[model samples]
Target: MLQRLAFILLAGMLGLAALLVLGIGFDRLSKVRQLDRLPITQLNALNDGIYATSGRVASDAGSLTAPYSQDSVVFVRYLLEEEYTNSKGERKVRTLDSGSSATDFSLVDGTGRAVVSLGLQISQVDWQIRQTHRQQNGSRIYTEHSLRAGDLVEILAHFDRSRQRFELPDRVAGLNAIVSHSSLKIEGGKSLLIAGLWISCATGLLAVGLAALLVGLGIHRYWVFVLVMTLGLMAVLWTIGLVQLKKDWQIAADLYGRRSAAVAAAPANPAALADLYAYYLMIERSASQWPDSLLFRMAAPYSFRVPTLPQDAQNRVRNRLAEVQSSRFAEQNWVLFVVAACWLLTGLLIHFALRAIRFKRLVEFIPTSKTTGLAYGISELFGMIEVDDRYPPLLSSVNQQKCVAYQYRIEEKRGSGKKARWVTLDEGGASTVFWLKDALGRVAVNPAGAKLIFPEKKVSHEGKIRRTESWLPPFRSIYCLGMAGIADAEASRLSLQNSADFGMLITTQTEQEVVRGQGALGFLLTGLALATSLLAGTVWLAGAGSLTPLDLLQVSLLVPLTLALITSILHYNGLVFLKNRVDKTRADIATLLQRRHDLWPQLLVTVQTFLAHEQDLQTALRAVRDGQTGASGQPQNIAGQLAHERQVMARLEAYPTLKGNELVQTFVAQMTRNEDELALIRTGYNNAVELYNNQIEQLPDLILAKSFGFSAAPMWQG
Candidate 1:
């Protein structure tokens, strides 16, 4: 049950991650296309909406120095990261420091200059300098990237007149405020650069997701469900966030309407005038809070102390405010939608993590013990790690520790505190096919594609450099689960040419011990998932906000239903993983048998050709010596034929370079290759027959085999 659950969860997680990436990619591609259509305008003729503008970043004496490169720059964002491994044997990259700085700068187009605010969003800044510093710690390394001044840039932002600066309107709160309140602002083309960055980020994420999905989906169908569910949930949540943003816009508009009416009434008394001035000041302070047209008209009448505006003017102002607010509202909803999508993505990751623990438990099911005497097909074999001459061992990269297989990584800290992160500098590993020795005998084991596990390792640090390494030292006990057979030799080994399947693993931990650990982890994940689901359901029930009891009940029921559905899917996937092993075994046996059949005819023809060239005197003597008589005096048996051919070859070897003798050498070469293949086929066929026979003769598996039409296969006798 645990194994099945884990398989399903893994499949689902991988699938969801893939779909999320694809959706992000499509969305990014659309944005990039939109940005591409934007015309680059001169600073003097800059419009209100988001548009591209190219200009030289005005260098100032007050511009700050970029940290790493010491370059003079108007703005810079720096980050430091460090890498470390947690107790669970997983490597984690953490941020150590990060900060950004900016100053007011003027953007100069060929025609004119526009003052731009440095506070505008900058998506991807071209870093003038990126340098790596090797710290004393063996496990960690550091690198830095920064942007400097005097760089040519393309800017995208709405030109705002209030702050007298170009800014990212999306960064501000409220739909009406962003659309009707703030004007386009740019400083070094940062805001439009931000838009380009978002599109690129989406595209990158989508590529990763699609690659992961394609790789995992080939192993199972459960990933398909994962992708569909993750995308569906994200879409639903995004729509909800947009709806909320729209509601906020309506409330803001209503407040603006009431404030506008009071100003137009014209106060007569000092108390009334004081009240009106107080209201005017409040509006002025939060200038971006109201619609653009409304704030402008409100300021003009009140700032100039106009007693009463014309009726036609008031209607015009009101209509213009409504039109501007509607456009802003639409514009603002996209930001909310992105936020909702990001939140749902985070939620899905958490969900996948919870399920991953359960799936990991399935690894414990891989067999670990003495497999020498057992019938082959697929078997788990246990042994101690050893080295062989075929592939020599090498010293580990970081620590110089001698091992048959070693993997190492180096990371550096970038930024400080909450904004810090660890980035990888260099990483690689080397491995070779080695030996696994036990009481049964020494078996040739392939370490390639094996999930290697090592003992606890302490990291060594020297100054800023840190290093961590993992290796399989000689004499360490190991477990391998794969196809086992004794081919052309006495010792039994697995015919593993590539990486093993997930269900079949090669690990250092014992099966029972690993199972116990994975089981504990699975239990914890299950508890967490259940608690989260229940909490979500309770929150829905308690504060559905004006929703009827029936509607609330429907929403509440969905939580458990969804949970149950997920569990069922995982369980079903597990069954598939288990059943596939049996099917694989059958297929392997059939393949070996087919190969033997194909090779036997070729071998026979070669032997016959060699015999036909020979001119022998003892025909009757040979007939009598070998079992030549078939039913009604036909040809000899295959074994008898092979014996006769060997005798002929022995006689011909005496005559060097003869026509028939040359044929004998060719026969010997072909026969040697043919014999090696036959030996492997014979061993695999015999083992498969034994395993199949044993399975059918057993209890539960016997019933399954019978139901599935797993009849006995003939063993090779020749």
Candidate 2:
């Protein structure tokens, strides 16, 4: 039973595989055929035909046309005279030499002319003798015109030469001739057989899919069956693709040959439309040769004689044709084909290989544990909670605590799976875990407090709790608090750092920032450098005639190089200046941070000391006056000035006896406000400095500075 089942499974799989392979092969073949359509190939052919015909006509015309002739006359022609009916139904006959030989003639249109001369050469003929016709309801008209000495010709030729007449023929004739004379019909039919094999292979792909499914269901020994079927299908598709390609190649080659003949026979005078057609033919021939030759080389088991031009002027022709030959073979179609084929094969192989494996053990091993009671169900019910406040409820629960009952509700899902799981509670709830339950009726664990039960699984909460004395560390928070007061000092320091007077490193940092557009200083340096470089170049060139080659090289090279070096030095100096300024700014900020740190601790002490002597007139006055004495003494004494103003205010408020003394209190109040304003100005300066420093360090400006050999400034530090 097992063996039978395996066989059946294998057969189905092979059938499906065959179908898929054949389908893909045919699809590819169809695409190839579509791509080979007349428009694309023929358009290319037309261009080549024009070029080749022009060359031949020009070559024949020799110096008469020389440069212009090579480009002017597109094709050569030979005329064949015969009587034909005109558009008015009148029969006319005219004798004229097409300039080549007789015998290359063929019947063309059934118009007034018996044979139409078609090529660039036909344009050489006088227009009076040709017929005219209107097409598309008179939208366009074709007329015969006379050729002048310098006029251009574009037409194909027809021959009337006797024994040599049939020497070379148009593409269509060439194909007919080959078919009639050769016995390759049987071989050609083999392509049809190959196509059939492809169809069969495609059928097998479908079979493979079916077999794989059966194997997954426990059929034994199916793999061996799959392997044999797959291999056979692949072989068949390969053969089909190959054979079809060969057949197409032969067809293209035959078409190309006929076109070449037509171009060769084209008329030289009165360049006709036929000449363009002939030129198009030549292009097709050249194109066809590439694929045919390539495939023949690759597929042929034995050495074959490669086609060659006829012996009369073969060497000269080959040499002359070298450029065209090279260009033609380098076309992209063949490369595209090879790439497409490789991709197709790779995809097919991967697909079939995967199907063949049919491994289901991995899937079968997955676990599905069920939670007991309503615990899981209730948990799921509580999982739906809205991240946004407005949403419908999924479930509701109540839990009692002390004298209050907390009400909770589950809302819509916030997200998916574990991430989505959530629960919401009414405003009065003390704990969310008490009322929640899973589908299995077990109590749901509260993730926030459950960590105590499983301590190892709990996230660490070390950083959360802390003494409330301060929210941030002293140095870090002081900058934020005293920004206004310190900013001006920082800006002044930064400016000094960018100045060239500070020497190379600081100046260079500044220049780099300017170049990088990080600071105003860099911009100034960049402009100066550009102007200097230009000036140097101009100066070097001005003395050009007076200098020898060596002298010119020395002078010119030195000018630019020297200027660049100077610029680099200047840039370096700017950076150093900027660094120095940054350092100074850092110092100022450090001082402010230190004062803030010290001030915070002294807040209670200062307040208590000032308030203790509040009622003692002499002591309070002495304290206020002594604080004022040292307030303005130091340049960096903002803290002292503030302390002094505080003491004076405390003295007045406590004394009341001093309230009527407006002058002293007023002076102290004004000083306090002035200090605050100065602090704000300093903050603004610091921010500006930070912005300038940051700008110099960013993109574009940074890139510019680096290009100019400018280095970055150090961060302001004290």
Candidate 3:
């Protein structure tokens, strides 16, 4: 049987170990796959375009109108400036001027090549251009431009294909050509296959390791099954990551090669250059919205390189760059890292905890030695003891140790089995102990035990004392006594004679101490909590700084700490206050009881006189109605009865007592209930005050509060 159990446990441990490994593997694979699919290049291209546009705007003039022609035709004129290299490799400048009415423009290159190109009509007298250019150095540029009427123009001379590049302007010297580039295209091969294999192998190994660890430690049976299923899921995710990584790697390599070739083949046509910039600008803009994608990073610069006809386009680009930098994009990365770290730490802690619980091999049980010397008996069975060599009798054990005796009151049914009659026991005395036997002579250890129970108190020569009577119902079958002792025949006889006298004195003293303690503690705690809360609020309110969202979050974090500190201080103060109040109240109650006792004789005498006055009044009224007295005699009798009535009323009204005594039975009861409610209200007020004060003192509110010279509000005392 032991071997089978061991085998089962081992199998479970292995299963759990496999599951943990699989979960970790799956998470890593998912992250890698997400990174692979990111459009980094595209984002990069867009970001660059925004920067370049702003830069160009700062240096260049606004758009201008084309001049009029002699044929009564309105010719819209604009300049396109570009740099190019001749066949001799010398840098040269090219300019192309087009008339709105002209259908063609001619360009002469430095090498005397002449080129003629047909003009395209642009409407709205508004110049809008979008372009894409691939440079020789393997960089792509995308540009977008919009120019209003009356903007300044700088023209670039173009190559004339017919003349074989023969144009030179005074400003053309030393101007270099703008080389263009394009993105590379990738295809499938061996590299992709290798990448996939690596991913699969790594994931499989992780899954297997996790499963083994889980199985090594015992977990719920359901979790073992879950681990098995998780392994398969992890494998599928790993495969997906492998495929994505392969695709991105190929694309990155291809893009690099294509950019180089595009830059080498130069175009002297300014219109073509403008068109290239505009196209790339669009591409870059599209990528900015996808910051996480790898393509955005690669494509972003393309937007920066695009040339603009007007200055405003460059300004727009520069503004975008500033915005991106100002956004604190880098900070977000740090935030993500911190959050992930925290989650990982939490998960690790949970895993360790589970492992600790599962592998707990130590067996612990109650020590039988601790129960030795304690009385062993069913508490309800009264005197009958189940004597065990290892365990002491319950009552006898507590008395000998000077430990408090606890008894549980129980209700047992006679006939109906389900219902029970409530019974109290004196477990310590002989009479109560002797009644524990059942019909068959077996000692009833359960509800049938009618053991006498005693309250805790110091035992004196007088008797085993009762400390206080609890008006509240006894909890379960338990009652407590001060000391542990077995009530044998000798002890029982002596205790019965002196118990009543001993009990009264102890009960009165105990009641006073307990009540006084509670009241004093409550008051002290409430005051302290309130004070600490206010102090914390004041300190926070006094600090200075502009409060951003992050600052607000920091302040919010402090809230719980502040609350905890305040609560602790309050609790301690409350205990002190309650203790003091309880002591004071107890003294007051004792005095009142003493005064009532002293006044009892006088009160009884007054009651007898009042009863006599009532009898005299009845006699007087009967004599007057029967006309049995003379007129003068009747008046004297009436006066005597009236005087007696007044005396009785005066005695009843003149009783010296505490205020509101008629409404309350005892001073202790009145003060306890009243002080308790007051304490509750005070506590609630302090909490509200603390919360409001803290909120106003922190972060965004704190900034506003300081500017206005706002101070922390005081807590309510009531």
Candidate 4:
């Protein structure tokens, strides 16, 4: 249920993001279309209204060197960055340079020029360079990025013809005008084709929304069908948008070409413009001299101008386009951010999907096998529990249920309502090597790391905040899967041989519910992987090269096919890690089995020896009753089988080595100690399993278990 909620939330966010991008695309496209219809005017035509024009920066005023590169620039801004180490030993970089700019330059057209006044706001300019230097103690300083001189500029400003200060002849004076509005806004290059971009973004948004709706409506099983259909429609829309963009570019180019040609052919004779220049000055002076008349007020803001050469107009248009392109390149933050988000989501989905796949394989490949005839490698084993009599049996602290091994935990609720949480007060569990007997034979199991999915017996107390105790009881038929190998042993040992590199360890409890969970995770992960991969591809292609969002859809249209290949490689690596863990765990289990195998024979021998001694002592007692008492000393307490037997023999040194009932009690005690030692050895094997399982389950270390495939072993119970 949590997963479903998370998924739905993510989908909603993505949809909203796409919608936002689409809207932005449409807005930009609208601006571009407006620019196309806007009438282009020459600088010589003075008027009192907003006007768009392009020109080159003039070095009429003194220049300052760009902070980083020290390049001469008429107007520029830059940032200085300094690097330092913080208290946490992390390196950080911060801007140290304050913003600076110069506006003491002039803008000139082929026919006339305007002296740009000081204190007027300039448009946003990205003219800066970056540099870095190391201090003696290894500190570093740098700049980010910068712009320099010779850059073309396109601007929209207010023009006023009444504020002219220069005294030129009537003809030239009429052409002179004042331009105001300090804040200059850099034009975007793609602004011309913005309408086409808008259409593309809107179409893309619709495609995604449609796909999402279909999937939400239960068409998810045939996701490829939805993807193919949407992609096809999107492709058509994109083609149309691109075609429109191409046409606009061609139109602008043609206009520039014609203007250039016209300028080249026009005669440069001053007499051709003499009549118009005289007429413009007479009208301008008359407009200012006379007021309150309809014609005077109507023509008051108009300034006549001589026609400039077509070549010069072409140059200005070309410069304007160049400036637009530069600005567009700089304004790519939105596109880059969207692309990054796509990659991040894709990566997350792929990561979880791969983990699910690994776990699924584990559930399928590991078959539950019988304890008898179990192979010497990692294998699943299940059987009835048998406890060795020598070692103490485990008793649950909560209910005091007897078992070979058990674990219990105590938890209490700490907070109330939504903030409530279960906090553990104290917890611990212990295990010993227990017998798992089937029809054929028995196998020892160590249940340390296994996710013990058993019928947990819980006891709850309605106290301050509800305390609960849960436990994994013993004696019931349980299953386990982990590393199985031979353990170290003496030469005379039979070596039941289980684990090697590490000891017996349980990774997970074998239960039916866990198997079902594995299957569910597998299916979910597979679906997520496919969906995320497609999303990444679509985002990459749709947002490529500054493409904007359609009304409701947004993404790049360019894709790198190698992303799929990389994902495959990552999955392979994950599989390799799992395989390695399985192999190691198998070796560890085998080592314990080997030692147990060797100890079994030695234990049998000790039991046989004890029986033989008992028989000999009985015979000696019979002799003593028959009036054949030996001249041996008093009997001593027996600490060990061999020692007690020798003591009995020494007492009868005058007679044969066979003694009487003098050491009978000692013999029984020796036998008991021997049996206990044997049980302890088996317990040692169980402990090893517990330790190995624990190491894998530790946080951070648990990452290995989750990724590399280390399953916990079930404890052996007698």
Best by lDDT: 1
Q: After superposition, how far is residue 139 of candidate 1 from its true place, in Å?
A: 44
Q: lDDT at 394 for candidate 2?
A: 19
lDDT of 3 by residue, 1-718 (tens): 4533553564455445434543443333222222222221211121111011110111122223323211211123333445677765677756543233222222222222122222242332222222212222212221223222222222222233233331222111112111111110010111122222233333334333333333333232322423342444334344443443344334433332233224324444443333334434433433343221355465446423445445665454445433321111123343345435534543343334332222121000001111112221101111223333322233422233221123322222233334433333333221111112222332212211222334443322212222222121111222111111223332111111112111211121222232223322322222222223322322222111111112222323332343334333333332333233233323333343333233334433444444455555335333333432212212223334334433533444443442234432243344344333333333323433454465455554465556655455444331
Best-to-worst order by TM-score is 1, 4, 2, 3
User: Which tens-of-lDDT digit does each residue in 1-718 have in candidate 1?
Assistant: 5555564455466446534543443232223323222334555544333434567677543677766556676666666677797765589888777766666666677877766664444433222332322232455444444334455665555455344456643322121111111222212122223322332333223323332333333322233434433454344334432343333333333433443344345334333333333333333332333232344454455342422445565454345333221101123344445445544553564466445533443444333445355344455677887776754667778787767778887877777666567777888888776677789876666666666676635476665556777877767887666655434343223443233554345678875545544444433343334334433432322221211122223433443455455554454444445555445544554443343334334433444454555435234224433433311111113335445545754654564443355444555565455445445544554554554565566654465556666565554455
The global C-alpha lDDT for each of the candidates, from Candidate 1 onward, is: 0.46, 0.31, 0.30, 0.44
RMSD versus native structure for model 3: 28.4
Relative to the true structure, candidate 4 reaches a TM of 0.38
Candidate 2 lDDT over 526-547, as tens digits, reads: 2223223322332232212111
TM-scores for the candidates: 0.39, 0.21, 0.20, 0.38
Candidate 2: list runs displaced more than 4 Å.
1-237, 249-312, 325-365, 368-718
Instruction: Write one digit per residue (lDDT tens) for candidate 4, span 543-598.
Output: 33233323113332321232233334434554454445544433433443333233
Of 1 and 3, the candidate ranking higher by TM-score: 1
Show model 1 residue runs off by greater than 4 Å.
1-366, 374-378, 388-392, 411-424, 482-506, 524-563, 597-718
